[model samples]
Target chain A: DAGVTQSPTHLIKTRGQQVTLRCSPKSGHDTVSWYQQALGQGPQFIFQYYEEEERQRGNFPDRFSGHQFPNYSSELNVNALLLGDSALYLCASSKLGLAGTSEQYFGPGTRLTVT
Target chain B: DQQVKQNSPSLSVQEGRISILNCDYTNSMFDYFLWYKKYPAEGPTFLISISSIKDKNEDGRFTVFLNKSAKHLSLHIVPSQPGDSAVYFCAALAPTLYNFNKFYFGSGTKLNVKP
Candidate 1:
């Protein structure tokens, strides 16, 4: 079975530009979540998508948004990118009902570099 | 504010020894905790987890301990091997009314098991 997969292993962008990263959840998974990991730091939650709607979001600004397709794939879009936005964007997938034991499997994050 | 904190940034231990990584959280509502291992250029992989109802959970050589009162959790790896050397992250899940189980992670701790 295929695990969670992410597109564009690495990206380079300039200030005030926009970038889109894609994610394919693990087989049999439905929920998709996005996270940002800076160098030498753990990931911080960006938001989560379930049933094609954004269910929850973190402290990030409005410049960050995402969408989930019917097939459980997801896309994270960041507009007006800043140097601080340069980090590893990670995608994680899990089932919905298993609330108590919600085990999330992650993908090989997309590294975004804003110059 | 960083809800989850891993004070130790790095640790080195001899092979075959017990490696203990600690994590503390400020949110009392966090009930489910997880530990993940990550290598360079790869997303974190789930290692083990423990819920608030259980103080300890074990799987093979990996174990996780949760202290609800103190809002602290820990991951223990027994007989640490060279292959076990990687960055370890601690995550806490908080349930909200929206039914979105969001995860907050700590500043990872890098472990080096010396042979």
Candidate 2:
């Protein structure tokens, strides 16, 4: 089965511009989560979506927002992007309830470059 | 503040030898720890994990050890293979009312196994 999938493998935007990234959950998975991985650093949780609603969010500011569709796919939108926003935006999917026990499979990630 | 830390940025070991990766966290509330491996241009893949209730968890050639008291964890790869060369990331989950699966990640360690 196709694991988590993300669109726009690469992107470039200028400061104050906005960018939208997409993610498709793995087969048989209902939960979708987004993360941002800076160069040479581990990923930082952006937010999680379940049942079409945001279930959790990280310390990121309001500029970062996300949505989950009925089909369990997700979109991460970053408004007013800054130079620091240039990084790999990763999307991970896993089943709920199993939570921390089960592993979250990640997508290839969207490489965002902010100028 | 960075809650999770992996001081080692990279490591090199000869094939068939033991490779150890270490991680430390400052958050006492972390309930689960996990390790993920990533190759260039790919998302991080789950390796192994250990819950706070357990001291160790093993799966085939990978093992994860958790020390709650010391707030330390480590991943040990036995008989390291050349294929194991990649970036290893350590992630910790801290219990929270809002985000149950929220994870704090450390700077990944790049491991190179030589033949």
Candidate 3:
């Protein structure tokens, strides 16, 4: 079965510019979450989408937003990006009530380079 | 503030030796702890995890230990190999009313297994 997949392996944007990254959930998964991993740091939660609605969000600013389609794919949009926004954007997928509740499979992150 | 912390930025060990990676969390409400292995240009791969109710979980040569009272967790790899060298991340799941899988991650610890 296919695992989680993300698009735009790499990207470059300037300050105040916007960028969009896409993610496809793993087969048989219905939940999608996004994370940001800065250099030398671990992944920080951005938000989570379930049933086409945002269910949870992290401490990130309003500039970061996301959506989940009916097919369980997701899109992370960062508006007015800053240099600090440069990081590896990670997408994870899991299903509710799965045998392992905390089992989240991740995709190869999209590296965002903001200049 | 970062709720999860892996104070050791790097670790090195000889092959066939025990490797212990530690993590501490400030949040007492964290219900689950997980360890992930990551390589350059890739997202984190789930390694092992332990729930708040459990003290330990083991799979083959990998084992995870949780100390709820101390708000700490640890990952142990036996007979480390060169291929095991990678950035290891610790993530904590703190679910809220709206989200069940939001995870907070640490800064990560880089493990280098020398052959």
Candidate 4:
């Protein structure tokens, strides 16, 4: 079984530009969560998608958005990105059952460099 | 403020020695805790986790001890191997009605197991 997979291992964008990264969750997973990790920092929760709807979000601004498809894949779109937006974008997959275990598997992450 | 924090930025230990990494959280609502290890250019790999109700959880080579009153947790790696040399992050999980995967991560501690 394949684990979580992300595309565009490395990306470069100019200030004010937009970028969209893709993620495919592991087999048999349903929920997807996006996170951002800056230099020398742990991953911060950006938002979470479940059943094709955004169920929860973190302290990030409106510029950060995400979508989940029926296939359990996800897309993270960042608009009008700033230099500070440059970070490693991580996608995590988990299963939420009646009694959730709250365990997650993460993708390799996409390194975004906004200049 | 950071809900989870790992004070030590880096730790160096000789091979076969035990490695103890500590983490603290300010949020009392965190009922579940986890530890993740990340190698360069890769996403975090889930190591082990413990629920707030349990004081300790042990796996083959990794053990996690949680002190609920102190709001502190620690990961102990016995007879560490060189492959364990990576950045270890401490994460806390608090489920809400909106999102069941509310994970808060610490800055991380880089472990260097010297041979």
Candidate 3: tens digits of C-alpha lDDT, residues B3-96: 9999999999999999999999999988878899999878789888888999999999999999898988999999899999999999887756
Candidate 3 — which pairs collide? none
- In the range A33-102, model 3's lDDT, one tens digit per residue, is 8999888899998998889998888899999999999899999999998999999999999886542454
Q: Against the true structure, what is each candidate's TM-score?
A: 0.97, 0.96, 0.95, 0.96
* Order by DockQ, highest first: 1, 2, 3, 4
Restricting to chain A, the TM-score for each candidate equals 0.96, 0.97, 0.95, 0.95
DockQ of each: 0.68, 0.66, 0.61, 0.58
lDDT of 1 by residue, A28-97 (tens): 8899999999988899999999999999889999999999999999999999999999999999998886
Task: Mark the regions of model 4 whose C-alpha exceeds 4 Å error after superposition.
Answer: A98-102
Summarize candidate 1's per-residue lDDT along B1-115 as a digit string, tens digits.
Answer: 9999999999999999999999999999887888889998888998888878899999999999888888888889998999999999998887676557888999999999999
Top-DockQ candidate index? 1
Where is model 1 more than 4 Å wrong at Cα? Answer: A99-102
In terms of lDDT, the poorest run of 10 residues in model 2 chain B is: B94-103
The better-scoring model by lDDT among 2 and 3 is 2
lDDT, residue A54, candidate 4: 87
Question: What is the C-alpha local distance difference test score of each model?
Answer: 0.91, 0.91, 0.89, 0.91
Model 4 chain A lowest lDDT segment of ten: A95-104
Over A1-115, each residue of candidate 4 has an lDDT whose tens digit, in order, gives 8799999999999999999999999888888999999999999999888899988789999999989988989999999999999999999998864113535889999999999
lDDT of the structure predicted as candidate 2: 0.91
DockQ of 1: 0.68
